[model samples]
Target: MSEDLPALMSYLDGLPEPHIVFDMDYRIVSANTAYLREFAQGQDVRGQTCYEVSHRFQAPCDQAGESCPRARALVSGQRERVLHLHHTPCGEAYVNIELAPLKDRRGRIRYFIEKMESLAHHHGAPGEQGMVGRAPAFRATLEMALRVAPSAASVLLLGESGTGKELMAKAIHEASPRASAPFVVVECASLSETLFESELFGHEKGAFTGATSARVGLAESANGGTLFLDEVGDIPMSMQVKLLRLLETGTFRRVGSSDLRHTDVRVIAATHRPLREMIAQQQFRVDLYHRLSTFPIRLPPLRERREDIPLLADTLLARVAPLRHLSIAPAGQHRLMSHPFSGNIRELRNVMERAALFCDGDVIELSHIEQALAADAWESGAPTALAVPMVSAPVPALPGHRQAQADAALWEAAQAHRGSRAELAASLGMSERSLYRKLKALKR
Candidate 1:
């Protein structure tokens, strides 16, 4: 049977339904064209572990609480079948999956043949827009988002920076009853206190010094739709009361206008900041926090769900590669998986974008990743020693040698210790003021 595996794969590929073969370890050995077209987007999926390709999981299906046909087939020595809600390229799909154990000459189970028949007519699973992941943490968040999408509840998204809070907010908007209405976004961090009211509630013609004509605020503009407040935690303490009133009453007066106006906008706020801590410190209003947190959803960071790294990298590459005309090599993907990704998905995107630019050929290599990581390290004041090799040769003292060495040392130290200027100065055994002076001189 092992010797005929190739012929068997060819036979399976000719079938109409999706078929796949995997070993006891759940490593996918072969997948039919139907499976590849539907799941892999026609990309090469050979040698990929089933968890990485199908479920985007780190472990076997049984470990992830999904019904494992392979386990059942192995135990009973009979065909096992189950209905599963699979995440496919088209969308979430309900499929009847059948698993039959393939035996060897010694009557030992060497592989399990999986056949999937679409049950979309039986159960329609909602598509998860572009949110990619099958990890429990990610799945939980996605479920919560989908559940709250149909409601009129004011959702508050909480997560670290670069955790795709905006994407989740958009997903909610897309899934909501007000899907046809506007989906406006307001960057709270970029909006100044003086402009916050005008930006949110709008103003009448000549209402203020800069108001030349009638203007509609984001809240009013998003009437019957969603108004996404990005970095909601950054809303000024002085303006928290105003925001609270708007949320509570669905009414607001424009800046310098006495006329009260009403809007039917759904609010979806997101922030990376710790609002509870802010409330304790009196930096943020407690009432506002409570009002905005009616449906708080926390997005998991990339580091917490490392198993989704491969799928995420592939998805990102699919979107970015065509623009740059570059594909990621196996080594590049492995390199990405090893990264800590402190900045989460945003950091990963940055690395991919940089690698795409660095790669001359169609395929991105390990060297491109190394170069991108080194450049990012330099910019962020992170350690570059690992990404970029240091010069092993000794420096010779000559005319202007001391200044040159000092510049090189300062640059290297900056890469090693990415922090405040005071910290960098202290690490270099110099006063903060002196460090500033040296930086200026170096610029000259």
Candidate 2:
């Protein structure tokens, strides 16, 4: 601490933007009110390490590829700036950070002042542009998307259903050179073999019974733009060959015509099914898979990136609040985090929507979430006993003895395999939220 520390702190606290002062050791010495409010959730942050607060890392920033700005400022004896995607109390946001060193009376660098400006507001809301996450898995996927966005290569997005593959494809298009042009989406699963060619390659007048007039298909309509093929795995073998021909030559004639029309369009495809397995099973063409997957990006499921749940929930709530006039209580958020969202973002959105409708007051509580989840369970006819699969042996009927023994066995099993709540819930054939509630009740 220096004699001028008090004055410096006062100046930083008066500034509007979030700012903090850290030592060479990366310990946060002081943080402005704005910084504390945004990052610390208004908790006491004195003496906390910067890595622990910002990244929840045991080591320093440099070890995690986020080189310490203070160290850079100290070496150069000048201010330094870096862009970082950080997980904050508000959500995951891109922040522009400026690091300036403060010197002691002896001219020795004592502390570094860090001023953070949020770039998310200026650019777009987090998760608004189709993707929203800060987890390492999600970050890696986003990095890949950005790296391949500028190129005209065909991108194949692989992920589970409701993992936002279409959104990622759209992101690629929005960042590409042909962003000004149309970005057409075609759902391959909905098109039949007879109509697939006409739907994608247009149809001439009197092409078929339903073809009343000439029509331009999605591929032609997407000229000089991007064409997204959703559920590519569902395209029949006959249709796959036509799609491959179009991708290979960029030329296709409308049905019932031999015009050999040409259209320059970038192709992006997504599928939840394992296309490699399909190829091995002789269901999908290997050559077409190679062409479509020039740049393959696999999205991580929600369970794999559970740390992003808070930000995701916040973003979802923000989008749904205005329409529903309802807000989620902290308890409601906890319930959401505990659940294994099998349908990923889509499931979360549906849950929130249902909760909003069921909520009587402004704040949605645990009961509202429970009712929504129960409704889903009822609709699906999911059994409650499925929550404990480890106890497979059926107990003998001995008055109330069998039921009591089964409960004991389930409790023991839940305690043993508690490493991953999601995996445990899956093994027990129940939602993670149900498992959490059961464990909480057992504790009581």
Candidate 3:
């Protein structure tokens, strides 16, 4: 090796950057220390192609040799940048790669130099974060979301806190025709009473104390797209009236501005509270309730779907796995299945990630999982076994009881294909009205 090779090795060893050199035949001639550590797991892996060496697999890249990035970079003799995807034993991550052509003194390109960088804010799997549910109930809810996603109808998602209602709303936006435009989300509970209207309807210059210049609100910002109103049930009555008017007229006036601006924003509201119950109590507007419930989607609680727990846990583990898949102990899986998920998918995810923190090697043992579950259980308060006293009450044949008994006997006789109610009433020598009343009374 030349002195330059020593300097290059010193400059590049274990730097954590993804770089590899592909020979003219698209085979990996040499790889930097970072590339070796990241791709090969520090094994003696040389004389393989870029894809085979980087992914530790010995096949034609993408099932087509020439279509590979390295091969293309070599052929074109031009630097190419592309977003590549790969799945490791641990989890899935996206890599942005720049492939450049390397030439010798004869001006002939000898090899292709590959530089790759991971662009994961919080890595793991793609399309998993924004939509995190695998339960049957979640599947049903997600199916409903997918069905409604293509339409522009107003969607009202109802669920408890931390159930990913906003995520569903975004899914609807992404799958809709307005996906090409902006998707705006607003937490309706954030604004104070004074700023509520201004926040939703925008404000002109000098509209109020801090209104120095003109400002567009969320509704305007989401024009020609979807506007997600999180915790929409929290909006004040005054704002509700304005929102209804905007929905009806498709026009809104900014604060302190006489001009009315028309917008094509589609509203997708979500709340954990029971709007119908709120309407009955006069807390929520009846008309607004009806308007928002154009397509209501209720997310079922996690406890209702115990069958889907294991699948969800496995999927979550796969999502958070490191370079190699975390070997979750069978006992840990058993414990996960045994517990009732009170917080739904969000809670399960937290448990898995926390458990992964204390895990050793590639295997996450029962002890670590237990520690995570126990800590979470303690945070939410330990579950206790309580015995309820079984009381033995004497049967009192009260008037109500006698009436119900008579009705049950008559219904049983009817079920047995006995005489008609009128015939039975005649047999008992009772009036038709009395028989009808008695029969009606027992149905309750």
Candidate 4:
């Protein structure tokens, strides 16, 4: 048995991907050189449990509420695959895990082989740009995107407005095999029927009023890469059949020319509207929907994955003010997390940008965030639903008069509220700890 371990290690060492062999008890029996360099930083991990080495958890992944591949392999006695956020040397990363069960002559499960492929294009933590999330919902959606990236199938991204559908589409494109080719975007909602066709499939010289010269369409431009149809639901009914034909046949004719052209491109379509409703209402075609939805991935809204708020806020702040080196105070972070963020990531970006502009110093406080949100709501013509009642009492003349008045108003609101501290804090557009800080500030 001991000699067999060396042979197994030698065999795995030749593989490029990270591989580790662990006993049924989950103890790391051996790690290949690739695994050592990628995950363990050349450290010996012979006796450590997989859970400890990968997640720093005392319990197994299944017990910790994660879908454990090893447990599933044990039951099925076959290979199992799962997407996992593993703690790597650099930081947390999304890795595709493939686990295969190893059995002895007696058909008894002895050890398991786990192979890990890191998703370099996506991040489990906040990055300078690109996808940043660790919430289970986001991870599930990301897994679907990654799984379908290598295939030639079409992808339909369904999500609410401002939920980062375009960003998700870009991620799929960058991860796909056609990454080296051009990625062309066609805004379906903004174009007329004639323009849509002309933009999508090109036009010959003098095809229409503006066709003075031969124009290459987006389909030709994205011949070897990806064509992203944003707001795809808005594509006119008259044009659906043409788009459907192009998708089904992989060929299309220019607006004026009778000659057909071919394109080797992957289609990624996104829409915020209800497509099923459109189909029922006869606004969208059923066949086109089927053609575009070879693999549909729903991007979880910001509210569904509130756990990612802090990470997203920090990342957005960095992008909003890369030169200022600004930071959000704990209270400001709490206030941000408590808000509804109705516009999702785009709205969050606006809030951070506004807050950065409002901050006179390096640190953004709760007051600055509140002002920014209020300004946004006002500029958008939204009612002042969160306006706290003014303090009727007079304030004596004092230094920092504006600060004193603001503190007085906050103190009055906190005292007048007749609900739980958490409820009051939320109603006041802040966190409980921030509420406590305001009261403490009043005392001083």
Candidate 5:
């Protein structure tokens, strides 16, 4: 209201930090330029309080247990700082806020100061620690890995797909005594079945077709650190013999070389398939299996460890936020927990990353979760029709409606039209995509 306040506001507004003053009622008495750009919602935010504009919550700061830094600043006279946080709907964009006591010339407290410093957490890059859950199985496995990481013993990670085996292997390497050494990964399953040995062991120059020059295999590439063998179960039966021999003798020759090369490389192998079963079936060598299984660790599926969903969700949301620059909302958390993530940790990360990429604002919503759920449906496999028990006692149709005599009528109609999939979908006001999905389920 005073002419001097306008001049003072102009001066403070020029600074990069978002700053503002709030009256005793929590109303925004005045704000700076950065504050307008950061929190403004089209209309003026000056007269409104923090709660009214951002949270849309009931009552003022105290009664609401308002835990944010801005709310604390408005209440206390002392200055304080908060870590990464958001006062808006989206949680991705971060800004640290500082509050200071404001006073008039007459020595009376007129308002409080709120200054913001932008930050980037509650969202950041995933280090070697991508395993986010805090389940007992996870903790125990981590402890076991850390214990063995300092030693040079080979490790064999066994778990279903989506359990983050590669992540665990990297964590072990990073925590090991040989952290400075190289950590190389080789996908045993991806190598061509005919050239598995040449891929793992360095080939001599002119060794075979397309061999222009000599090259070091993964074992030689990771001389001192770790060599992660993903999907070890898929290693061809013939190559398994060479691998076993290399592990036992610590020496292996190139595909076409006679000289033996020795190396000290820690091997960490992972597989989703049943190795013991393969051994029994004569598909995998028993000697090779034993050599790789010196120290075995298995990761539990997400469903078996449901309690860690929230923690994993938070970790993933934080991890996903920085990459795509979007935030995950509390409302989307439930849907994430409910969905059966057959793809496991990898699925969770992919879903979250997708949500961040597709979502508009900093805050992720239910729609994002829905998008993630739909995208992963194909990977989860189609549901089996009639396998799901029908609802008991479907007696009659609605009071004034008579589309079908009973709910079963709808099922029959869908089945009858199932023959002409497209025409059936159009007749029933359903999508062709939905019809195909339903038909697949019925077949299953």
Candidate 6:
């Protein structure tokens, strides 16, 4: 440490947010009181590498496939900011990292000062509830959310159906300055054209044939908070102009009333359909689309982040069967990873719940997974092959006679198999644990 390093640390301690000073090699030179209090829990982190202390990684963040703000700042000779999932005393949380390269009198970068601000509403790993996954695709969406949260910018969430758009909207609201206020949702798809205006803007008594009493609209109900418009693409075209007016003027009037009402609510909109195509076809208004998409974020589909299936399954299983403490076996997990979830996280949750119902034991097995998927297809009035596309061969039928025959064939194939167990398990449409168990039974 330099002689003036103590003076620098004294300056950092006077500041508010968590701050750390580290050398170009990523070794921590000193930490501010805020850093020790929030991140280190009062423990000193002077000698350890920043990556090791923050992420528990052996190498730097970029080496471990994450964006490194320090590296970017070093190149640009300016401050750089990034979102990262850091290990904290509470758990793994999404944090905003701001790194600024400090140059010496000779114009050479000597040290770096990093600041961290945790996103309280988000988690990097699966917990009992809330958001999960640490994949790159998921992180990108979260980073955008964090960047726009502090401000009152209108956000638009774009993704396929069942990709958890509503959840993402709520997360943004919770992370924003409006965390204490209401977070209301308007299901645009379900509202009829006649009811759309009345629901969005309150209706006075005797406004329509069925208007028995005065009711508050969602916009007024979400005053000083957030109003999430789910499936904004499905909103009736006839009512698009009204919505546009409300967003533009922040003023509305109840049905059958002349008085205009004002609200200070922030708006968040989500949709699965492409707004640009809708605009081209004249199905949606161009002005409204621009108003709602000030900061658009696209959520990733499940297939893009397959490694999160197990964590999501475990979390959903706990919610679906809380008392049973059920779990998915390795083979069951492989089966889940094999299918392309067109419905995304929503479909995955349904599969986990159905599999829980099929399995009577504590652990959900491969057979249970197959039966649940088949049942889902049958209920949807589609054949298994057509409904859920499998990446490899089709899953075997679960009838007793057919299962026995399938086992015999699997045993023969296992005997001739030469690849790794993981490859063999994937090829057989089963887990390695299941294969090992079956082989041991045959030997016995």
Highest lDDT scorer: 6
Model 6 agreement with the true structure over 157-240: per-residue lDDT tens digits: 999998889888998998889999999999999999988889999899999999999999999999999999999999988899
Residue 187 displacement (Å), model 6: 1.2
TM-score, cand. 5? 0.57
lDDT tens string, model 2, 1-444?
A: 577788889998988899888887888889999998888888877798877887778888888776567667777999987656666866656666778888877778888888886644312134544567767787677667766877999999999998889888887787679989999999999999988899999999998998889999999999999999999999999888889999999999999898999999999999999999999999999999999999999999998887777677656766776665566666556556667788998888887777677665676655465555545555656532123233222122323543443345446545444256876666444577977997787778
Worst 10 residues of 5 by lDDT: 385-394
Clashing pairs in 3: none
Model 3, 79-128: lDDT tens digits are 87654444443454545567887676777776667787653321223333
- Give the TM-score of each candidate: 0.63, 0.65, 0.56, 0.86, 0.57, 0.84
- Which prediction has the highest TM-score against the true structure? 4
- What is the C-alpha local distance difference test score of each model? 0.76, 0.76, 0.66, 0.83, 0.67, 0.84
Per-candidate count of clashing residue pairs (backbone under 3 Å): 0, 0, 0, 0, 2, 0
308 Cα displacement, candidate 1 (Å): 1.6
Task: List the pairs of residues colliding in candidate 1.
Answer: none
Please list the residue runs of candidate 3 whose C-alpha ends up more than 4 Å from where it truly belongs after superposition.
1-135, 318-324, 384-444
Error of 3 at 367 (Å): 2.0
User: Candidate 2 — worst ten consecutive residues by lDDT sum?
Assistant: 385-394
Residue pairs in steric clash, candidate 2? none
Q: Give the alpha carbon lDDT tens digit for every residue of 1-444 in model 5.
A: 345677878888898777787877788878888777766743578777766665466666446654455456546646765433245434333344567766677755666777765432221222223454445566566657766777888899999898888988997797687789999998888898767888789898899998999988878888888889999998888788888887888799987899999978888999999999998999999888888988999888887776677567667767767555455555456556655677787788888877776565566664455455545433444332111222122122232222222123335445433245554444333466975775566555
Candidate 1 accuracy as TM-score: 0.63
